[model samples]
Target chain A: MKLIVSVKRVIDYNIKVRVKADNTGVDLANVKMALNPFCEIAVEEAIRLKEAGVASEVVVVSIGPTAVQEQLRTALALGADRAIHVETDELPEPLNVAKLLAKVIEAEQPGLVILGKQSIDSDNNQVGQMLAALAGRPQGTFASEVKVEGGKVLVTREVDGGLRTLSLDLPAIVTTDLRLNEPRYAKLPDIMKAKRKPLDVKTPADLGVELKQHITQLKVETPAQREAGIKVDSVDALIDKLKNEAKVI
Target chain B: MNILLDSIEKVVGSQNVLRGEDVRSRTADWMTKEPCLAGAIVRPANTEQLSEVMALCYEANQAVVTHGGLTGLVRGGMASSDELVISLERMTQIESIDCVSGTMTVQAGAPLQSVQEAADQAEMQFNLDLGARGSCTIGGNIATNAGGIRVIRYGMMRDLVLGVEAVLADGTVVNSMNTMLKNNAGYDLKQLFIGSEGTLGIVTRAVLKLHPQLTATNTALVACEDFNSLTGLLQHARKSLGGELCAFEVMWSSYYSLLTTESNRHTPPISSDAPYYVLIESLGAEQKESHERFEKAIESAFEKGLLIDAVLASSDHQREKLWAIREDVEGLAHLLAPRFAFDISLPILEMDKYVRKLQSAVSQRWKNAKVIVFGHLGDGNLHVSVATGDASDETREAVESLVYEPLKLMGGSVSAEHGIGLKKRKYLNLSRTPAEIALMQTLKIALDPRGLLNRNKVLPDILA
Candidate 1:
């Protein structure tokens, strides 16, 4: 069984993001970028399934401009068998991305598809469900644990209060959460070999999809800096201060 | 001694003086996990309090050892049963940071990691970093002139320190707290205590130089087939990376294999079959351009046959993992127990031949000894450890001879970054000439006439 994992390139989580002086957007001219952390978890899960003999191959796909290939190469180094790049100059809306992924899924016909629950950049948690709807397959969203048993994918989802288990048939989609598995560092030999691995780059038009921007961003501003709070001696004093000074009672 | 302890208690407060079991419970040595044997441990709140306590000790002719974070490999912080320990544990305040001037005024007892974090929070960096950053104190780092991975780019602790505030043995405070980048007002008095290993005086506070924090970091673990290629690769990285090269750590296959394969403590990032592996790093202002330059350097090194195999970390996590393998000193110590660890520096060209000769000498005596070698090659320092299943004093002396005797001819120092504390004091002659030794002795006598501070450390005993 072939496992397909979708990845996205985003600003590295370690960077302290800066807002442009003009308030246009984040100042990301030379910021460090890496595979979105959640996407890395998804790729790690797919690779583990292959290592466990449940999946014969792991293929990673990403959609963006040429810069996204760096993330694709990273996934390949992390033991993905191959990669497909749905190249476009601008990032598409979630619906359009799902459409493009649906076309790739049809062409590859993988038994399982994995994706991060949301992209950290956009924080849009709709792509997996939309792709499942487009591909006519069941999806297990916010998966904390995933297991393949007897031609069925068992996914344990982290919900509002507790974990909920869901069993989906073959050809299912699973969106990874925080606790699926910890990713492994790519070995040196694998990184060198990843350079030689096959990476097929195609346009969104080739996938029968068109990129579109649905939401308009008006302006960006940094959040207000929090002021340091004073320490109160006792609960009664804290209550009195909160009620009288803060007027929160 | 009891009267002296009582006087110290009065100066620093009764609660600050620990006696009996409290003094016995604290650890004195990091390697042996030995409990402190000091009769009493005094915690000074600040430089003034410490000076008053020192005066009391001086009046009574009491010998005292200053304890920071007791993480020295040379047993420099060790205290005897009759001695008193002056611990700077309570004087750990970060006084102030001059962001415009790029300097931080910090108390001595602050951990090195905390100072680094503070600098980082202020958009600057403290370049002295090591495996023991979490536990080692800034005072200890300053005392030993600590050199770690980044010494290739930033000089040792001496270079990072702008000024120091120390309490002399006779209770005189030398407040040479100069915060300027270029100060030629008079003799640099701070240099006396910078690398003296707390023998001359106790460092109570320091003004440290800080650098602008580099936003971009590139790391790679490259394999070399031979030592020549490894040195060539270092030169190539230095030239190609264009002074952005921060670290060039080379690990011998024997050391790498022991930690990764033999002990199974670490996951080997690359095959340990190569004769050598180098962890190269570069820091820059911007990400995209720096990464491009880093990649070009590595690619050219490969094309020039300076490296056999290489892997560039795709993310910060991967970069840390690559560094973990190089910084596995605890793993090496655990696996090579009953081992003689040597931190020596020689000319880069002589390191390969010296290690081979030392290995043969060690194995000839122990028959099945293992010699592990690795260190900051860019700084001409190598940490060599030999395990022969015995840690006896006689065996230790023999092994020390095998390591230190050859360095005299090779023009290498017996102690590299780890100062010549009690462990390497006897071998000081191997690294220093008679004139240098006499001058060191004269300085020690002039500064600490009564030898009341950190006695029997960093200096050998006078001939009877």
Candidate 2:
């Protein structure tokens, strides 16, 4: 069976993101970008299934500008069999992307479609559910554990209180959570060979789908910095400040 | 009484002074797991504030122990309840990076990791690196004259430091902040404080020299069948690698195997076999040509019977794993408890015989004792550790005597990189002559007449 994974490019976690002076968006000039953490987990899960011999092939897809191919190549380096880049100037809304993915699913008909719970960038948390609705398949979101048997996938999802388990038949959609698996480092030898892997590029027109946007972002800004706190000399002083200065107690 | 505390508070605002439970909350040093024994710790913001604080303490006849990251291998940063700590924790600031001069002026307390990162951003590096870079401070490195993995290419901390700003015991600030490569103007005052271990003065700030960041770094771990092969391989690397040879670290089979196999330790990239393993690294400008030369060097070493097996790290991830095996010795702390670590400098020719004799002597003393040896073979520095399964005071004393007893005859110094703290005070005479000791004492009396700045360290206490 074939496993299709969705990979997205996001800012590297170690870097401190800078907000633009005009508040247009994050200033990404010359900043290091890497595969989204959740997406990496999704790729890792797909690779595990392939390693277990349950999946014959793993194909990773990314939808964005030309630069996003870097993330696709990284996924290939990490053990994905092949890559497909749906070329577009900007990422579409979750619903439009779900429609585009649905078109790809109709053509390829993969047994499992794994995606990140949400891209760290934008963080819509809607693509997996929308894709499941468009494809008419059972869905598992925020999956922490996944087990596969004959014709079914048991997904343990992360919920508010604890984990909840659900069983979905094959040809299902599942989004990965942090605990799905620890991603492996792309080995040097594999990275060198990943450049040779097949990477097919196409536009939304090639997939017989039209991309459209519904929501418009007016501006983006960084969160306000918290004020530094002062240490109190004693418990009495702390309580006094809380009652009079902080005015909360 | 609170009078002295109030005086110190006046010097460096009341909030900067940490006492009572706060002092107890901090660990003594990187090695000691126990709470610190300090009357109070004053964190001055910059050089002026530190000078004022020192003045107040000096007038009160108080003993002040300067504190950095507390990552000293020797007990140099150790303090007792009678001593007050002048911690540079609050003075952490990378004031500026002068690209033209290739220098960085930093307050004494900035962590080495951030300094390295900042230098990297400026397309340069301080080239003073060690395993403790994450936790240690630039001040501590300067105070100890730290010699790390790259000493072969970039010399020790003393060579990297261009100038230093130190506060004397009498609270006088001596700022020799020179940012030039060639400044032969009079006596360089920075040399006195570089490796004085805080006895001469408390280092408050420093102007550190930086080097152009090397674009190409090639690393490999090779197995050596014998000591002669290790020497031959070193010669081969020196010839083939040219001036790009940066690090050549040798780990004896005992330590290499122990750390690689220890629980929570980084697994070795190459199989742990043979009597020794040498980690070779070369950094240069041309990546392709340097890599070719490095590979050729290793291949020639193997062809000439200088090395048995070799594995090159082709990626940063692979290189980091090989380095982790050397840097994360703390992972084996549980198995090697009650260990004695010695950083000794001796002739490279004397190492093989010295190690064999030391191991034999330690085994005869403790039947189950294990000797783990590793260090920078290029710098004539050996870090020898002995674990006797006992951390008792008697065991520590016995191991110290065993390690230092033969050093005098070999014309070796008791310490190579780590300065003599309270731990090695008694062994000072073994390394320094009586006249040299007298001169050191005379200078100590002349500069710090009160004998308060890091007293009873690096030199033997007066024998009444």
Candidate 3:
């Protein structure tokens, strides 16, 4: 069995993001970028499956411009057997990304596909479900734990209230959550070896996927600075202040 | 000391004064973990309270040892059974940050890590960093004139500190807290207390200079087959990275292999086959351009045969892993216990020959001795640890001779950044001339007349 993991490059969590003066979007000119934290979890899950002998290979895939290859190579260093780069300049929507992933899935025919629940850059948690719909396969979203045995993958998912267990048939899609697994540091020798790993790049047109934009971002602004709260001597003062100042009563 | 404890308790409050087991419960230093042998531990709330306590001690002629984080390796904070300990643990307040002047005003007891974090929160860098930052205090850093990984770029703690407020032996508070860069009006009085090891005066507060926070940091672990290439690479990096180059740490093969062996926790990032591994770090203003420049510089170095192999950290996580291998001082301590650790510095050109000569001398004395060397090579400092199976006083003395004797001829220092504390006080003459020692004595006698402050620590005792 083979496993396919999808990753995305996003702004590093350490960076203090700055919004453009025009309020159109966040500035990304010279900011540090890394594999999305959630995508790292997805890559860790796929690599763990391969290490456990449940899967024979782990192939990582990413879609973006040339910079995305850096993240793909990072995934390869973290124990992915190979990498595939779906090269495109424009940022693609969830449906288009799902279409591109479905094309790669058709060609590779992996037994399992793991993806982050959402990319941190967009926070639109629909790619896994859309890919499942396009590929016609079962999906376990927001998976905390995954166990594969006898041609079936048991996924324990984190739901609104508690964990929900689902048994997906062979050749299923599992979207990783925060609690899936912690990623390991790439070893020195492994990193050297990753440079030699096969990374095949193909254009989005080669995958029969056309980029489309459906949503228009109007403006992006930083949240307003919260005003300091005042102290009240008693509950009566609090009630009176809330009613008069806040005007909520 | 007992006569002064009453007045000390009155000034700092009784609960702030600890005695017997309350005092011994604390460790003497960061490394030894020995029971503190002070008569009483006094925790003053602020600089004024500490001044009052020091006044009482001075009147009684009581010997006192100033404690700041207790992380010094040279037994600088060690106190005897009859002496009192004036611990700065409670005087840790960050007064304010003047962004316009680019300075942070902090109490002496503020931990180095807190100061660094505070500066970072203000979008500024403190510039002084070390392995013991979490426990070491600003006062101690100032007292020792601490130098760490970035000294090559940012200068030492003496350069980082703009001014200091200290209390003298007779409890005279000298508040020379000048926050300007160019204050040459008269004698820079703060220099007297900066690296005196708490022997002249106790630093109560300091105004530290801060630099703009770095946006991009590029780190790489490169291998050099020979010492010449290592020095060559350092010069090349200095020429290429210029002011942006912050740290250039080198680990000898013995140090690297021992810490990164298969059984060790760190997997060797680069094969431990090379004679030297240099951890090169550069910090810059722009991320994209700095990264491109770093890559180009490294590629050119490789092409010029200055480095045999290299691994550039692709992400922040990878960068930390590479640093972990370099900062594995604990791993070295555990592996080479009963070791005599020496922090010495010389001309960079003499380091290779010095280490080789010291290694042969150590092995000749003890056949099974393991001599491990690694440090901030860019700053001309190397931390050499030698273990010959026994930690006896005779063995320590023998090893110390093997390490310090050669440094005398090379015009090197016995104590590089650690200072001439109790451990290296005997060998102070090796690093300083007779006139320098006499002048140091004159200053010590002038400042601390009764020798009540950190007695017999940094300066040697005057013979009767």
Tell me the tens digit of each residue's lDDT in model 1 across A133-166.
9999999999999999999999999988999999
Candidate 2 clashes between residue pairs 3 or more apart in a chain or in different chains: none
TM-score of 2: 0.76
The C-alpha stretches of model 3 lying farther than 4 A from their native spots are: A1-5, A14-29, A37-60, A64-69, A72-96, A106-126, A138-249
Provide the TM-score for each candidate, comma-separated.
Answer: 0.89, 0.76, 0.85
Candidate 2 DockQ vs. native: 0.07
- Candidate 3 per-residue lDDT, tens place, A17-132, comes to 88999999999987899898888999988888888888899999999898898889889988999999999896688989999999999999999999999987789999999999
Q: Compose the digit string of candidate 2's lDDT tens values, residues A118-159.
A: 988788999999999999999988999998987999999888
Candidate 2 local lDDT, residue B14: 94
Runs of candidate 1 with Cα error greater than 4 angstroms are A1-3, A14-29, A44-59, A76-96, A107-111, A120-125, A140-170, A176-249
Shift in Å, residue A85, candidate 2: 4.0
Provide the interface RMSD of candidate 3 in angstroms, 1 decimal place: 3.7
Best by DockQ: 1
Descending-TM-score candidate ranking = 1, 3, 2
Error of 3 at B78 (Å): 0.8
Interface RMSD of 1: 2.6
lDDT by residue (B264-372, candidate 3, tens digit) is 7697766888999999999999987787778778877887899988887766877888898888778788888878899999999999999999889989989999999
